[model samples]
Target: MNDFPWLSVLLVLPLLGAITVALLPRGRDALAKQTALGFAAATAVLGIVLAFRFDSGGPRFQFTQSTPWIEAFGVDFALGLDGVALTMVVLSVVLVPLVILASWRDAERSGGTGVPPKRSVKTYFALILALETMMIGVFAATDVFLFYVFFEAMLIPVYFIIGSYGGPQRSYAAVKFLLYSLFGGLVMLVSVLWLFPLSSRKVSEGGLGAATFSFEELSGMTIEPTTAKWLFLGFFLAFAIKAPLVPVHTWLPDLAQQAPPGALVLIVGVLDKVGTYGMLRFCLELFPGAAQWATPVVLGLAVLSIIYGAILAIGQVDLKRLVAYTSVSHFGFIVLGIFGMTYAGQSGAVLYMVNHGFSTAALFLLVGFLIVRRGSARIDAFGGVQKKAPVLAGLFLVAGLSGLSLPGLAPFVSEFMVLTGTFTQYRVAAVLAAVGIVLAAIYILWMYQRTMGGPATEQVSGLSDLSVREKVAVAPVIAVIVVLGFFPQPVLNVINPSVETTQTVLDRPGFRPQITGDVAENGARP
Candidate 1:
């Protein structure tokens, strides 16, 4: 199993599917949808197989493969997975088919009430499959250069998806998304280029002996403190924009308002995770000293994002924008967990990524259904939805509650872990961050009441319940949320080991471990 090219195959399957879907003759939209769904499902099955074969206690990086690509620069076509990467891979694969299913009618002219998609149905599905390939590749790439390639290349399909198939302001939104991402990428590229010469220099001169982009090699090398901080900032800027943390998070609500709901699912649900994941995998691992140096400021920004996002969400008139703001808030929690620098904190942060994906996906899809029914995304455009579509209302409520991290839901456990872990170290920050939870309940319930409660308004009185396809699309996500809420130990078991490895990296001298008085007394550091 270790000898198999698991990650390569996982990436290729979706790429091949995209090509096959695109090449099919015109007027076969149904066939294209089926073909794309089949390919996504197959890729998902492979991901599951890979996950089951993963040994939690085995080598840090399993199913590894490395082959020189640009040998002159020591870059390689490398791919590998630790527990964290594996969990993310599984999340991406599992969501793609579900997104495909939910978006079954997204490209068709008669699919819904809003302005129809301008692109061909076949092209739409093809873009989705192509995006899947990029998502998997970004998570799997073990070479820094290869990871950057996947990172920037992701913009292509997403650009087209939003600009071509999205709503009235899509072109503007797409351009904004592109420009922000491109600038971040360019800055990071400068940092990436800088690493080569540094790596080529001799160890006595603070070099790693050979120029290389292999993550494992680079992580093990030591760079000057000032140089490491700059590199760390470069990478952190890219991830932060992607994470869309406060201040830099301006692009997301605009994108969410304009993008098709299905595309939005992958954007917030999975794509945005690349930022948080990079913070966990690259930033902290490669520059532990800088990471520790930046902890105080990072935690401050995270707490600010948490409050700012929730407050804005409370004032949103548009359903899609409301969900988008909620995500900004949720991401703050993820970031908070990460910088807390404790085992429980990092582990919870990782699990939060997966759980948030499902909950946010469900919210966006349900909102999409509402928009389709009424031809508007405004909260005022809906009323007494429950009277006409009980199932839709019920499901929306459950998804909404999950977003608020209600007890016995998937998000609650992860949220709790993150707070528990962070509280032990950064007590004030954790306490301040908890305020976001209260605000979350306000925004979520208020949105639900306006959209789903009360007497059936004439406009929404005729709203139909979820169709069979819609039900099938959302059932699995909801099930996962409920199941994981009660039994998260399984997922935690897989995530804890990798987080332990990360803790080991962060535990070097000069980093403080404030998790408990006993640890401080014992002279333990992180």
Candidate 2:
């Protein structure tokens, strides 16, 4: 453990608050909400200080701690933070508190349907805090078994949230989500079981070590080409389910429309990153040979998702569902960057995740605002909103333009890096992906024009402009998007070294990751 157990404290505060909230009286709903916000705020502050203290020149993992949990089976309760995981930790800490604040006014607000309260305020806040703990744990755990534990545990709270508090088709959507996610889990579990023995042989005399699940140890070893490919499938399947890539993504659009607005924003914006993060962490580091072996097949799939997601998005009448499909299209660029195997591609992919997080959050939150007023998410339901709500229109433009990766915005730099890198390795994939980018412009601009510029609908003309608090809620996110565009060096400084370390692991003999970085080193094209 580092001198300070800051990571543990950060993970535990929200869980402890959940307990405290449960003890408070029913009429103390305001007190419960305040307590939740307080814990989230404290965690955010800690995450900032941890970021400042983090040495950018250090090894891959830091602030590490380990303790034995199940010695007989060779599992331990271990935790650590790396530049990549720590970045996500900071994002989560900041976003969760803001989510609490965003939902503050709606405290104790009844669910969508007219039914007796099946869950108490204490229980609701408890689930939120519990979900936060698991989310952080997923990023921080170094032990493979521990990571799996946190990963599977998170589904419980989220499933209940959408099922109990969501819209009309909540039950159906919840079941579909469960089925897709569970299948992935079973596959991942089988892979983990196979990995344990192979790792055991490498670390000890045919016995798994207490520190067997530690990422550094596992990464230092190698696996056979045939075995590595099979293990990679376990992880990829799980991430694809979570990432909801392509043909497997049918669940997201339906779930988005059914879940509560706050939940939808958090699920799509923050939680979904866990899937991509897992691939970067486990599939890349733990199974580098397998990653290289599997790159082409997955690259093909990502291209399919890009064109397919965009085409589907263009035809959507449901506004919320339209926004949901855009995530699939955006993640296609991320996958292309990863498999392209260039430092620029992977780095751009990393930055894209952060950029996408902020932009998507704004879009979803803003749409939620519209739904509250219009009582529907149909694109045609919103006509000439700019006439009545100028601020709202402007905010949507900022988010939409960011989504389109307009130059001068954060995504542009990353997208350029990704496309440039992909051109060298996956030339045809890059070209097809470019078509997806053009579709990005078509769907985004067209959706904006149809909703914001036409004659004001008779019903929506009286809609009020964004409240000061709502503007305050989203302004920081927009500022981050524009600010990062101009000065991405700070993020790149952290990202480049970590990305280099990943490439080093992938370049070992007998494994080829299709990587290219001489351009950046030689100060040429890339």
Candidate 3:
């Protein structure tokens, strides 16, 4: 199993699919869709196989592959996965096909209320496949340079998807998204370039020979404190923007409002996760002392995002924008868990990433369906939809409740673990962050009441129920949310080791765990 190039196959299959879909005859849109879904489904099945084969108790990074790429620069085309990366990989693969299924008619002229794509439907499907390939590559990469390549490559397809296929203001939204991301990427590139020289100096000073862009090699270097902090800030700034944390989060609402629901799922649900994921995988692991130094500020920003995002969500008139703001809020929690630097906190953060993907996907798809039926994104455009489309309303309620972290739902367990972990250390921050949960309930329930409750408006009185295709699209996501809610241990088991490994970095020299009062009795430190 180890000898198999599982990661390569996973990456290439979707790329091949993209090429194949793009090459299909112009009129064969149905064949293009089926081909894309087939490839996505096959890739998903392989992802499941890869997950089952992962040995939690074995090497930290399994199914490893390494070969020279830019030898003069000491970079490698390395790919591997820890438990965290494995889980993320599985999440990415699982969602792509669902997004494809839900978006079956998205590119068609009569598909929905939104404007049809300016390009061919084949182009739309092709872009999706290309995006899928980049998604897997970003998670699977074990080299810093390679990760950066994948990270920036993601923007290309997304840019085209939104600008060509989105709503009226899509061009503006896509440009804004691109500019924000490009600024962050440019800033981070300075730090990435600096790393080689820094690593070389540290290695030579210690009697070691050459430097490398390999993650493992850079992680082992003893960088100067000030330099490390600067490098950390460079990387952290980029991730915070990607995470769309508070101040940097302005682009998301615009993009969300304009993007097609299918692309939106991958953007907010899976792609945004890259930010928090980078924080966990690179920020803390590669620069522990600097990470600890930045935690107070990061946590402060996180709390602000949580409160600000929720407060804004309550006032949203657009359904897509409402869900987008909630995501900003949810991301705050994910960031909080990450910087909390406890085993439970980090583990829960990872789980939250996965759960958020499903919950948000469900909400967006359902909202997309509503907009298709009513020809409006405004909240007031709907009322008493439950009277006409009971099944759709019911599912929306489930997805909404999950967003609020209702008990017995997937997000609840992860949210609980995050608070439990953080409270033992930063009690005040945790408490402030908890307020976001109450605010979440408000926005979610109020949105539901407005759209799914009340008397049916004449406009919505004839709203149709979810089609068989729509149901097929969302059923798997809702099932995972419920099943994981009750039985999260399997995923947790996979995440725990990586969380522990990350936490250990904080215990080294120059770093300290700040465990408070009675909570310290449970364990010395998380």
Question: How would you encode candidate 1's per-residue C-alpha lDDT over 1-526 as one tens digit per residue?
Answer: 6677888899999999999999999999999999999999999999999999999989988999988899999899999999999988999999999999998887774224365777889999999999999999999999999999999999999999888888888889999999999999999999888888877874446556567888888888777899999999999999999998988999999999998888889999999999999999999998998998999999999999999999999999999899999999999999999999988889999999999999999999898888878878899999999999999999999999999999999999999989888887898999999999999999999999998999999999778999999999999999999999999999998998999988888877765554557646765333
Reference-based TM-score of each model: 0.97, 0.94, 0.98
- lDDT per residue as tens, model 3, 19-65: 99999999999999999999999999999999999999888899899
Model 2 weakest 10-residue run by lDDT: 107-116
Candidate 2 residue pairs in backbone clash:
none
Deviating ranges (above 4 Å) for candidate 1? 109-113, 202-209, 513-526
Output the worst ten-in-a-row residue range by lDDT, candidate 3: 108-117
Indicate the worst ten consecutive residues by lDDT in candidate 1: 109-118
Best by lDDT: 3
lDDT of 2 by residue, 1-526 (tens): 3788877888888888778777888877778888887887887888888888887798677888788898865777888887778877877777777677665543244232222334666666666777888888998999888998888888888887777766678789889988888888889999888877787676565433433766777777677778888989998999988986887888899988777666666788778888878887789988888887788888898899889999899999988889889999888888888877777888888888778888888787788777767767788888899999999999999999988899988888888888888887778899989998899999999999988988788978789998877787778778988998888888888777888888787677766533347644665432
For model 3, the stretches where C-alpha displacement exceeds 4 angstroms are 110-113, 206-209, 521-524
Better of 1 and 2 by lDDT: 1
Ranked candidates, highest lDDT first = 3, 1, 2
